[model samples]
Each structure stands twice: as structure tokens, then as C-alpha cells.
Target: MNIRFDGKRALVTGAGKGIGRDVVKKLVECGAETIALSRTQSDLDSLKQECPSIIPVLCDLADSESISTALKDCGPIDLLVNNAAIAICESFFDANTADFDKTFDINVKATIVVSQIVAKGMIERKAGGSIVNVSSQASLRGLKNHLIYAASKAAVDSVTRTMSLELGPHNIRTNAVNPTVTNTAMAKVGWSDPVKVKAMTSLIPLGRFAEVSEVVSVILFLLSDFSSMVSGSCVPIDGGCVAS
Candidate 1:
């Protein structure tokens, strides 16, 4: 299928690196007027330089005020990907309120904040849109040091469902993409040890983690008209890790 977004506008958070960075590039290639949001100016500058026409917004997703102010003039986004997230690896016993608050603020709360800001315009224009929340496979099942991270993602899934239900009437769709340890900077942080990586990979039927393109493909599909009927779903691009 020739998926295109010639005249549409898309906004992606965490566009500084990894999966989020790749998703923005793909959107630009697909003909969308894309906006890349990142807390780091260098990441946005390089992305804009690479994509030329891409708009770059600088905002730290952890701050609700920053998110709101940065995106207030986004102007009727047709697609949004709440891909900004951070993971503080603390075992259940070791986790604290500080880490918990930080995780939820970005992974769960920022997703809601950005979606709400963008969705209001969609509702006003009566134009509808799509939102993809970048959750994690850790959300499905517990992990050793993923206590707070897992909880935040579980909340993201809940957000996806509720938004889909409420926004469906307005022709808006919301979904979550849960990916296993992809070869990204974040993966390096959590899956750095060879022993841990080996142990983790062994559980997946594919015997491997995912690539950025693999996850980006699914995100773009959901953002496009191709996934018109697929909403309120937690789709896993985990190489069957979740299934296995």
C-alpha cells in the first residue's frame, strides 16, 4: 500500500533520539508537515537540518507547563505520537516517590497533556486524529528493576483505551505500541549487561529484540488512514516477546 500524508501535520515527542527520532524522519519522508519535539535543542537542530522542512519544538515533557506552553500554538495537528519517556530502574523495594513521579509525569502525564492539547483542536475542527502512545513490554509483565516504569506504562495503556472510547465519537483514534528491548539508547541503559540481554532475548520466540524501523513502521501505519478501524488497542511490536 502506498501510505502517504501529503497535507497532514504530525507531532512527535522525544524526537531527540531512538525510536521517536526515527518516527519523525519517517513522517517527513511520508510527506507530512512534521514537528519534532525534544528537550534537547541539538537533537531538534540536527533533525531539522536533516529533514529541512521539519519544525522543531523544544519542551521537557516532564513539566506539564512546558508541554502546554510549547504546544499551545501547534495549530490543529492531524497526528500525535506521545513517545517521550524515561525509565528509572529501581526494584520494587528500592523504588521511591521521586522516581515514580518522574516516570509518570512523562510517560503517563505528558502523553495525556499533549494529547489533550492536540485533541481539543481536533474536536474543535471536527477533523479527528490519531494518537500513538509508546509504551513498553515491561507494562504487560513485571521485570526485575522496572517497578515504576511498568506501572507508568500500564497507566498509558489505560489512557489509550479511555481516550479511544471518548474520542471515537469525534472520529479520533488512540492506540499504544508496546515494544520489547529495541536497539536504542534506552535499551542500552536497561539491557546493557550481556547476561541480562541474553536472558531476555531467550524468552522471545524471535530470539532477538526489535529495530527502530520495525517499531516505526507500525507507528506510521497507525497514524495513517490505513488503520482507520484499529483503535483502543495495545499493539505489540515486540518480535513475539509478549506472545512468547
Candidate 2:
């Protein structure tokens, strides 16, 4: 069970906190040289304080220019984890147009652009690396008040499948991790209602939320050689929520 990514180079988006931060730390711990990208300098600074070996890059997924600049400095990446995303817990009728645009920009568009740039480098080098897009169970089923967010993630799932097919010939494998109701600060924002939380948890056969480490373990497996033949599929780490 000792999966090691020793000597790999990884770039993780939204590594300022939550799942992204944990993923960067986990990758580094597994022996991959990691570059953490986020819009907040302080968060990146904090990560550096904790792990000085991690290289921090400031990049806003919403800004094309910033993303391009950050990629330029990234040089080449052996593994790309598109983990940045945004959401708003409001009915479709109450959702703001601006928020809708912003949500798609970060959740879908940014993931695509960044992956293309990095995957190109991987292809040219013939490195045949792996891409783990942080998708969600939202893409699998509809959720109340998650109109825009669900749409955005649905696109990610679709893109993952397409990328897998397009990149398969080049030896690049693209897949996604679809997690359900993980106990992250971000997840709490959507599950604040007591009734909603209980209802969602009840649907899960495991009857609980996943720890951040659980999700990180799945990502690590996908990045490592253990999943060398797995691609273009959505692996649900949903506590069996999808089964019920």
C-alpha cells in the first residue's frame, strides 16, 4: 500500500486551502516536487511555512493572463490536478448572472485551459502523465439549489471523458474523482441546513461524510502507477451515495 510518486513534478490549482492544500502536501510527502497555485499570497505563504519545499505560484483561475503566466513559470508538469472550483448555495431563480459566469470560469473553463497547457508539455516530452480532475457527485445527480454548480461539474466530467479519449493515443490518461458531501469548509457552506445535511447523509450507505484524507488517498492512487490502466472514468468516493 506504499504508493510512492518519487521524483514526479506536480502542479495543483487552488492549493491555498481545503482539498487543494491537502493534495499538495500529500503529493510532496509522497516524494513529488509540487507547485501550489492560488490567488491568495498569504495562503501560499502559509503552505510554504508548513512545507518549504513546495513552490508557490500565484494564479487566479478566473484570469486568463494570470493562468498563462503561472503556467509559463511552471515549466513542465508530470501530473496535473485541476482542483479549483466555486459554488453558491441558492435557488436558480435567486442566482446572480455574475456569479454564474464566475462559477463556470473557474470550475469548467479554467480546468480545461490549464489542463491543455500542461498536457501539451506532457505529450511533447512523451511523458504520458495523469490528470485527476476534482469533480463531484453533483455531476452524477441533481441537487437542489445547485443549478449552476452542477452544470459546471457536469462539464468537467464530460471533459474528463473526452480528454481521456483524445489523450489516450498519446499515453496521457485523464480521469476524475467524484466526492460527495466531504466535511471540508467548502462543503459545509452547502450543507448548513440541518434537514438537508441529514437527508444527504441518509442517502449515503456509509451514513457519513468523507474525511479530507480519504479523498486525498483516492487522488494519490490515481496519480501513482497503481491506476496506470484506469482512465476516462469517474470514480465516486461518495460513501456509496451513488449506489443508493
- In order, candidate lDDTs are 0.92, 0.91
RMSD of 1: 0.8
Model 2: per-residue lDDT, tens digit, 1-244? 8988787899999999899999999999999999999989999999999999999999889986578777787777989899999878778798888888999999999999999999999989998999999999999987989988988899999999999999999899899999998878799789888999899889899998889999999998998889989999899999888888
Reference-based TM-score of each model:
0.98, 0.98
Candidate RMSDs in order: 0.8, 0.9
lDDT at 106 for candidate 2?
Answer: 96
lDDT of 1 by residue, 71-170 (tens): 8777779999999999888888999998989889989999998999999999999999999999989889678988999999999999999999999999
Worst 10 residues of 2 by lDDT: 64-73
Instruction: Please give the TM-score that candidate 1 achieves against the real structure.
Output: 0.98
Q: Model 1 segments beyond 4 Å from truth?
A: none
Clash tally for model 1: 0
